[model samples]
Target: MPNLQDVILYESKHQEKDFVQPHSHQTHQILYVLDGQGRCQLNEHTSPLKPDSMIVIPPHTEHSILAASKMTVLILEFSHLHVDADTREFLIKPVFKETKVWSLNLFVSSEIRQLLRKMLYEQSQESIEYKLGIKLLLSQLLFILMRTNQSMAQLDSNTLRSSWLKEYIDSNFYQITSIEEMAGKMGISSRYMNQMFTEVYDQTPMRYLTEVRLTRVKKMLTETDLDIVTICFEVGFESLSTFYRVFKKQVGVPPNRYRTTYVGMSDE
Candidate 1:
């Protein structure tokens, strides 16, 4: 959807006192810290950089990074055409129009780390379809960042209730009975909480909880030899029929088939 161009993606490690002089890029630049600490000087403002933190520099913005300790960072630079008008306005324009930096929560940090690593692998391989792979991955990365920004915006007037909701779901997805119940625990109306959560997460609370369960289902299917029905209830699915149906729809295969295929691949 992004149709990104002139892409440059790479990793950098800096020792203490290392500095990157003030510079500007014609393309939007994203710097994500993988380890250690630093400080980013953006125009007249400065922001701290620690592990799992990211800074998004809008096109032509003056910025520099100074490492206060050993640091590893992934840098991605790209420009895009208006091929997807909706993406430009909703995802790219709003999120990247200004220099912004934020620390990622554990769930988002893990996901973004995996995506960035895949992009690095694609860049290194330079395979025939690497360009396409990079474009898709970059688009996904941007979408995740956009949702994260939306969640942060929800708490700008108060506290990060959306983040709290996500963390709670991540930790207790298997035991979560209903969104209304969860909302009640948070001292909010189910309707209101669902609206706020969906606005920030781009999905309803139930959908997010389902996704978390499915992610666990996938891992257990590949890594363990548990029976499908057992795994289903373990992951908190109430009905075998529903589990099979939803697993097939979301994963494109039934649980047994997925396990079989993955096991065969691992053996090979």
Candidate 2:
């Protein structure tokens, strides 16, 4: 049950002659750069503002702006009251943090730019129901921004988890015996770990683990004089027959033959 209050719009053109001294306001500001380039100073940090760059400035945050060239900016300012608890905690709080500037590229699509333009037009009109139209547009825009942010966050988190899992396999391949054990260490189910591995690496977790073991076996075969059984055990293979089968299938040769071929090449 959020209420929007004091909705105002400002479309301004600025050049080298214009300057805004440091200031703050009580209402949240959504500023979009329509054209040209500029620089915004929010407290101690300065960010370059280009066409289609949108910024959300929180309440009572000191900020200033200077035009690097001729610039046109469309700013929407408003305050909200009685926002739902979850929305306030997640979407609103993050954007309104004093130390953070919520910025996104509005020029990612022509549709987005058109939507903002429509909102601006509605805001400028004094016709019947224009206020309602502006409010609806603003709500839609906020929804899009929140959804985009959530999607990007999820992608980043998945990427980080994938990287950590790969590093774990790389470092612990010698001791890892099964996919379940690896997944257990990470406190996730084997099936979910496999799914993550498949999505990120295009292979199942157990398959990737086997690949890691086989890669080490090949390295040992080429670089060291270790016997086939010793190399197999060192690479965490519990069964000689299974190791030989996998090695022949994946490397197209038995372990001894692979070592011999590598040795012959080095000698030649």
Candidate 3:
């Protein structure tokens, strides 16, 4: 169960010259743009406002909003301090750490907007249960945000995994030799490996490997006194002729000429 504190709703219209000066609040706020456009400045970061822009401002964080035009915004302010520790931590930390704006248009459903409207309606009521209704709706909204955060965390994990895969490839590129061998070492099919690489890097796995090899080769050619033939085999090219062909094709110069040109530049 969660406890709600200082639960309040505000729907305000701002003219072009009207603005809220930078300030801090004791309770968390969900500021949803209902109409018009503006810019919200939260601490050092600023986000553009439009319809469906929801900004989550953490407790005690300085923020302000200025309208670009006649703008309307709905703000829901509450605290989750009395909630279970995990829920409280989840609600407070990540929302402020990441991008503050959660554009409602990106979600698959419009349930959040509906819930906010329902809460607004409940706030207008004179009945005793209206308070309970507002709390319930607010809780639902927090859970939705939590779920969205979890999904984003999973995406971050996938991105980290992709990064690890690229690093592994970079470290072992000289010995791995082929896409199939690279895939075998990772325990995935080459096709799937290529798919993952392409998704993250926008290039096939083999192309990325080639780029890595080419970069190393370019560095060696520029910095080392090694002969082209030795440099070619050392950088893991099996055929000297194939190396020369690729070097020319990708770099617009053969390896020997590239090395000579680098030396000439260094002498200047």
Best by TM-score: 2
Q: Write candidate 1's Cα lDDT for 142-260 as tens digits.
A: 89999988877766632478788889999998788887789998899988888878877888888999999999998888888889989999988989999999999999999898998
What TM-score would each prediction reach against the true structure? 0.58, 0.76, 0.60
Whole-model Cα lDDT of every candidate shown, in order: 0.85, 0.76, 0.78
Ranking by lDDT: 1, 3, 2
What lDDT does candidate 3 reach at residue 52? Answer: 85
The CA-based lDDT of model 2 is what? Answer: 0.76
- Residue-level lDDT tens digits of model 2 in 1-268: 1235646677889996467788987777878788888788888799888887777788788888888889998887777652445655766665555533345544443555676788778867888888778766666666676676676577677677878899998888878888789888888888887777778889876787789999889888888888888998898888999999999999998989888778646445
TM-score of 2: 0.76
* Residue 15 accuracy (lDDT) in model 1: 97
- Residue 43: error of model 1 in Å? 1.5
lDDT of 2 at 77: 78
| Model 2 / residue 12 / CA error / Å | 4.2
**RMSD to the hidden true structure, all candidates:** 16.2, 4.4, 7.1
Candidate 3 lDDT tens digits, 146-194:
7787776765665676687789868877776777887787787988777
